[model samples]
Target chain A: MKIAIVGSGAIGLYYGALLQRNGHEVAFLMRSDLEVAKRDGVRVIRTDDEFTLDRVAAFGDSEEIGVSDLVIVSIKATANQSLPKMLDPLVDETTQLLTLQNGLGNDQFLKARFPNNKVFGGLCFVCLNRIAPAVVKNFMKGSVSIGPSDGADASEAETLVSVFSEAGVKARFEPDLLGIQWKKLVWNVPFNGLAIAAGGVCTDVIVESPELCSEAKALMEEIMAAANQFGYTFRDGFADYQIEITQPMGPYRPSSMIDFVEGRPVEVEAIWGEPLRQAKAAGVAMPKLEMLYALLKRICK
Target chain B: MKIAIVGSGAIGLYYGALLQRNGHEVAFLMRSDLEVAKRDGVRVIRTDDEFTLDRVAAFGDSEEIGVSDLVIVSIKATANQSLPKMLDPLVDETTQLLTLQNGLGNDQFLKARFPNNKVFGGLCFVCLNRIAPAVVKNFMKGSVSIGPSDGADASEAETLVSVFSEAGVKARFEPDLLGIQWKKLVWNVPFNGLAIAAGGVCTDVIVESPELCSEAKALMEEIMAAANQFGYTFRDGFADYQIEITQPMGPYRPSSMIDFVEGRPVEVEAIWGEPLRQAKAAGVAMPKLEMLYALLKRICK
Candidate 1:
């Protein structure tokens, strides 16, 4: 399989590394680290198996990468406007473009850009960070739930999952990818929003404050309520479920907080704003997400 | 009239200076600035008239100030826990205490502490900063809406207004003080919370961001909704009304933002938490205020 990673961030690097090790031809659509990656491999720091891979090709221009079997769109959603133009040289009719990005509108965005190409979405359940240029730290999970965003019953997703599984990645095909995205947002809207809202405090600060915890839970409930309007009903106590899973991370700050600290623009548009927009379009009153989106917009870009 | 100004911070000092200039026997219950105020007196650095009055007495202990006819409690609501003990010596049976403080619960707090005394609230529409110990800069207005908080029409409130008026302060007695508190909160919860939520940016930034302005306006509507449940139905577009008044302030930072910047504890309990509690009691859902209160609790305290 010839696979190309769209953006060389954490998810892009980690998965691309695995795919490359599995004997797939992988190319990275590189940025400023283009020279460094070409000189010395992209480094993956892990407790079990840490290695640097210089075997894969790194291309600064999308034209140099050419059309591939799979193009994983892992760029920050803040850069969505440029994705069409950036990926134009690489996407063809048979190109299976899988977005491992955050937010609701990416599939529509890509579809609008390349009408004939098969656009897939993967909710990458991962906690990783790109600490330095061409270097990524996989702190935890890298499982992906993949499916076709255009409502196609995907035997195509199964083939993609096999390639991912061969690379030692946990991959599964879900028929309801949009529902999974909504489920991800139940956690994303509250935890990511609250972390930034409290001026970049971590999970420990949230758990310690009863009001914050309840507010987090309430935001999750609000997300579920908004989902229900779109005929997507999550289980009861979904917020608590997220908290129980996240509590083990122990004083961890999420990606939005990390962006805030580094003076980088946050992906609030993709993660917070779009969901609120969809909720409003559905005539759902997600007051919490509305306020969170507003706050994030004011603080971030 | 013999008046003792408790909590000699910016609000206390500025208003107390006006009273002293009006020939009232004013004794300041000073904090860390006792020595400086005693040496050079509290300085009012106004553009029109900046003066240092040495004739007014300044005392460190409330016991030294003794029981006065009127005790203007201009302390931060964060100091409410100590009010019972601190104001014990200064508040007597006839000591009409006017709380020129922020938030909803100041009168109730003082009433809780000094049950025998007349407890009133002054929703001060002022913008001033204490640049140094006992030195306050009046940047803008000093109009106070004075009234009884417990829905009692007391004649003392009218007298208090007259004294405040004579002291060159724009003072008026509002029979419905709690409603005014809610109206003020329509402004407070948005500006104060948004300022800190935007990483401590001022009003200029908030006004510039369309998302923030709409969010602030939405929060105001939520507050009015909550107030309506308590039989306080304010007119429609109250949010717009407040914004029009605040837009001219030009890059202003509210008191809560200042408190947050100085690392002083914010009055989340009085300003945010109590109103939320009341809203909940009235079976109202103020999701915006709840989230703001939670964020403020995590960051400020």
Candidate 2:
């Protein structure tokens, strides 16, 4: 399979390199890391295994990687405006467009822009960071949940999951795309938003403070409530499970927090704004998420 | 009236100096600013008028100030624990106690500590800062509202208002202490909390952004809702009025925000926590205030 990786940040570089190692022809669309990818060629540093694709194809222009079988978008949602132009050269009628971006609306955005291509969305439950140019670090290689967006077939999402599995990754296909998004947001809305909103602290700080912990759970409950309006029901104690799972990720910097601290544009619209809007439109009141969204927009701006 | 001012922050210095300049014997119970106050007295710099009280008595210990006709408590709510000890020497059965602190519960604390003494609570609507030791700058000399706590008489509050009015301060006698606190919190909870929570901004920053402006209004509405449960009703468009009045202040930092940015303890309990607890007890749901209180507790901690 020939795959084109767009917005080659940490998720893009790590996953793209893995697919390339598994014999898939992978080409990365790079920006600041283009020269580094050509010279050092995308290094993935993990605790157990470290590898580098020394001479993989890296292009500055999307047209050079034209018409791939699969196009994986891992860009920050702040730069979603460039998606149509970038994906135009790589997307064909048969090409599957999988967005590995955070928050809601990315898959919807892709589906709207490239109506002919099959659109899928994947939520990466991994702790990965690009330490330096073309140099990726994986603190936790968690699984990925791939789901077909509206009008996309479930079997296509399953095929993409199998592709990830072949590259030594834990990937699962989810039929309900919106449900999976709310589930992921149950964690992201609080942890990612609070990490920056609570003065650039980390998961540990939030989990340690009783006030912050309860606030996080409240945010999760609000997300769950909004999800319920869309026919998605979370089991009782889901919010507790989310907090419990985050306890071990001590002082972990969320990707959004990293973006905010490093002076990069955050995906405020996609992550916080869109969810609040969708929840309101569904007639579900998410006061906590709404306030958090307002704060994030102000801080990120 | 012979008055003793405790915790000589901006509010303490400005008001205390005014009374002393008006020929009343005013003694300041100071800490770091004791020497400066004793040397150069206290200076109040305002847009219209500036005055200095030279050779005024400045005592490091409240005991040295002795029992006074009135004792003004101007400390941060974070230091409320030290009240009993500090007030012991300065407060007698005839010594009236007036707490000009932000938020709720200060008057209650005083009433509990000194049951025989008349307890009064004053909410100062001013923009004042202690720029240097014993030197206070007042950008706006907004009025103060005084009201008696439980068991205190309305006439007593009126007398305190006269004391303030004698010193050329625009002081009003409010019959409802809790109502005034809630009314002030309609502005404080969002403006003060967001100023710190939104990366240490000012009132202008909160008013400028549409998201933040709406958030401030929502917070005000939540406060009004809670106030309604307690038989307090605000005028229509009160939130808009709060924002409109704040717009002309242009980047004015709230006292709590100043405390946070200067590495001093903020009055999280008095300003946010106590009100939230009280509102919940009153069967009023204030999700915005609850979340803001949580963020403030974590950030200020």
Candidate 3:
């Protein structure tokens, strides 16, 4: 499979190198940083492994790349508004457009942009950080879930999973990817919102302060309730499970938190603001989530 | 009238100099840093005026002081735990002990410790900072409300108002001193709790984020409701009035906020923890206050 990974940040570079190492043709649709990476190749540093791939293709413009079997969109949530136009050159009838981005409304926007293409919903449950232009450090091991956006046949899902597994990336095919999306949505809206707002680590919030932990939990519960009102059934303890698993990931800060600390634009609208809008539209009372969204919006502004 | 002022910090020195200028025989209860002040006497730099009073007695130990007509206790709230014992020699049966300390539960503790002495509630609404050992800089002019803690005769209240008026301190005597105390209580709990827990300034918390502002307002409202349940009627728009008056006070941080920045022992128990306990006892729900209290306690730990 020929894979083009867009927005060549840490996640993009990590997966692109893995897929390339597995005998698949992987290219990066990158910005100016990729020019240096093209000459020197990409370096990935994981806790369990480290490698430098020198045969990877890098492009500044998506138009420079030819057609591919798959295109993974892994840009920051704040960059999604301009991503569709940037990705126009990479879309074809058989192109599988997968978005493994954080936030709630990216899938809808992607669908609206590429209606004819097979857009898949994806969520990555790992922690990775870009230490340099071409170097990414994977701090934890987690899987990715992907499925057809509009409930299509399972053949494409199986093929994508096989491609990911063959590349040493754990990927699962979910029949109801929306459920997983909402589940991820519930966790991010509260944890990411607070981590950005409070300027601290996750353990500093969850372990040190029971009030903040409980409030964050209540916000997640409200998001889950809002999702249920919209015909989604979240498993019990979904929020607690995410908190438990993510707490041990040593001093890990969410991307939104990192963005705020670095004085960059945040994904308040997608991760928090849009879900709050949807909840209100569905007549579900999400006071905690509403408060978190309003707070994050104010911080972003 | 003879008056002895204990805990000669900024507020303490301000009240002491004011009382001395009002023709009262005033003395300051001095600490180690105030040794120079004890030798040279007290100095006050007011907004409209500045003066220094010589021959004002200063004593390090309360046991060395003579009896007084009034004893003004103007220490920090956290220091109030050992204050009653410190005042053992200066406080007589006729000496009315007025606490100008910030936060709740101080009066109850004072009354408990000095059961036979007259304990009056004093709430100061001014901004003063100690610039030097002998000098206090008054940045704002505000009133002090004083009244009997046990709802006794109005004579003690009248005397307090008269003394404060003569000393150039805007002072009023409220028959329902508990109501005023509760009003101040509501304001301090939310702003102080948030500022301390987040380790930020008041305006930084209130103006930078709508979520923080709303959370603050919710906490204030919960405290107000709890106060009302305890038979106190607060004036309308109290919280808004406090925010308006304090926001432009020129980047002034609350004491609790200062404590967090300085890593000092915070008065979390008095300001937030005790009121939460009172609310629970009064059968009033205070989710926001409880959460804030819990967060501050954890941070302090």
Candidate 4:
């Protein structure tokens, strides 16, 4: 199968390299990393594993990659405005669109942009960063949670999950896209938001501070409450689960915090704004999330 | 009346100089400003008025200032731990203790420490900064809302108000100290809190952004709601009034923001935490204020 990786930042590069290494043809649509990628391909480094996909197809223009079996969109939501132009050249009616973007609205966005294409959203439960152009580092590895967009068949998510699993990613199918998105938000809204809003600290700083830690838990509970109103309830002790899992990340700088401190555009709207909007529209009160969103919209931008 | 100014920062120096100019014997209990104030006295600068006390008393030890008819405490609430040591020398059974500290707990703390002494709280609705060791710049001048702490006579507040008025400082007596504190918090919880939590911004920066400005208003509403539950109600349009009044201060750094940027300890607990605690104790829901307090606790500290 041929796969075109759009928005080839760290997530795109890491997964694309894995798919290519699994004997599937993968093409990366590059920007600043185009030259380096074309010259030496892409590099993926993990704590215990590292691989180089030498001579993989790398394209500066999306048109060069053309239509393929699958097109993965992994751009930061701040740069989502370019999706139409970037994805237009590589997607056809039969091509499935899997958006591995963070937060809400990407799957819906792609679906709106490509009405006839099958849209699936992939939530990467892993920690990855682009250390340098064409070089990606995975500090932690977790499974991908894939779900079909509204009106997309459930089987499509299973197919996409298997596709990811074949490429060595532990992938699972989530029938409720919004549910999984909210589940991801249970973690993202607080950790990512606080990491930036608390003057750009890391997970360890947030976890160590009792005030911040409780606030993080409160934010998670608020997100879960909003999720419940939307028929996406979580099991008991979910907030604790999120916090407990995050403890080992140590001084890990979340992706949004990385974007914030490094002077890049953060995905403020998709990660925070969209969820807040959806919750409020559904008549759910998310005061903490609303405040968090307001702060992020101001400081992160 | 012999007035000794304890915790002589900006507010202390300005008011003490005013009282001294009005023929009152005023002595300032100093820290780093002791030598400069002794040699140069105190300089008070405003938009249209500037004065320098040529031979004011400045003391390194509070004991040197001795007992006074009135002891005005203007220290940052973060340094409340030193209150007993600092105030013990100047405050006596008859020396009325007037605290001009920001937020809720200072008056209560002082009252508890000096059970025999009368305690008054003053909410300074002015913008003043300690520009140098012995210099204070007042960009905006407003009245100090004076009130008596619990168990203190209302006549005591009236006397304190007259004392300030005679010294050329705008003053008004509020019968309810907690009410006035909440009224002041309707501004402080948002403007002062946001100024620091929005990554050390000024009043103008907060007022300029629509999101932040609305957030400021929302925070004021939350505070007002909490105040209402505590039986302290403001007239309608109070939030609007707070926002309108803040607009002209153009880039004015609220004292908390100044403390934040200058690496001085801020009154996070006094300005945010104490109000949050009081409101929560009264079973009032102030989600925005609570979250703002959380962020301030993590960042401002």
Q: Say which candidate scores most in lDDT.
A: 2
Cα-based TM-score, every candidate: 0.92, 0.94, 0.85, 0.94
* Candidate order by decreasing lDDT: 2, 4, 1, 3
Across A170-206, the per-residue lDDT of candidate 4 in tens digits comes to: 9999988888898999999999999988888999998
Query: What tens-digit string does per-residue lDDT give for candidate 3 at B155-237?
Result: 97788888898877889998776677777776678677666555465555564456677777777788889879878876799
**Any runs in candidate 1 off by more than 4 Å, and if so which?**
A45-49, A151-153, B45-55, B149-153
Candidate 3 or 1, higher DockQ = 1
- List the candidate 2 regions with Cα displacement exceeding 4 Å: none
Give lDDT tens digits, candidate 4, residues B76-151.
7888998899888787788899999888888989989998889899998898989999999999889899988999
Clashes by residue pair, model 4: none
Docking class of 3: acceptable
Q: Provide C-alpha RMSD values for all models, in order.
A: 2.7, 2.2, 3.8, 2.2
- Which regions of candidate 4 fall more than 4 Å away from where they truly are? none
lDDT of 2 at B55: 80
Q: Give the true-contact fraction for every prediction, in order.
A: 0.86, 0.74, 0.19, 0.69
Tens-place lDDT digits, model 2, residues B1-301: 8899998999999999988888899989999898988899888899988888888789999888899999999987899998889999998789999999889888989998898889999999888989999999999888999999998999989999999999899999999998998888888889999999888999999999888888889889988999898888988989899999999999899989999999999988888898899989988888888788888888888
| Candidate closest to the true structure, highest DockQ | 1
Docking class of 4: medium
Q: How many backbone clashes does candidate 1 have?
A: 0
Identify the superior model by TM-score, candidate 1 or candidate 3: 1
User: Candidate 3: what lDDT?
Assistant: 0.76
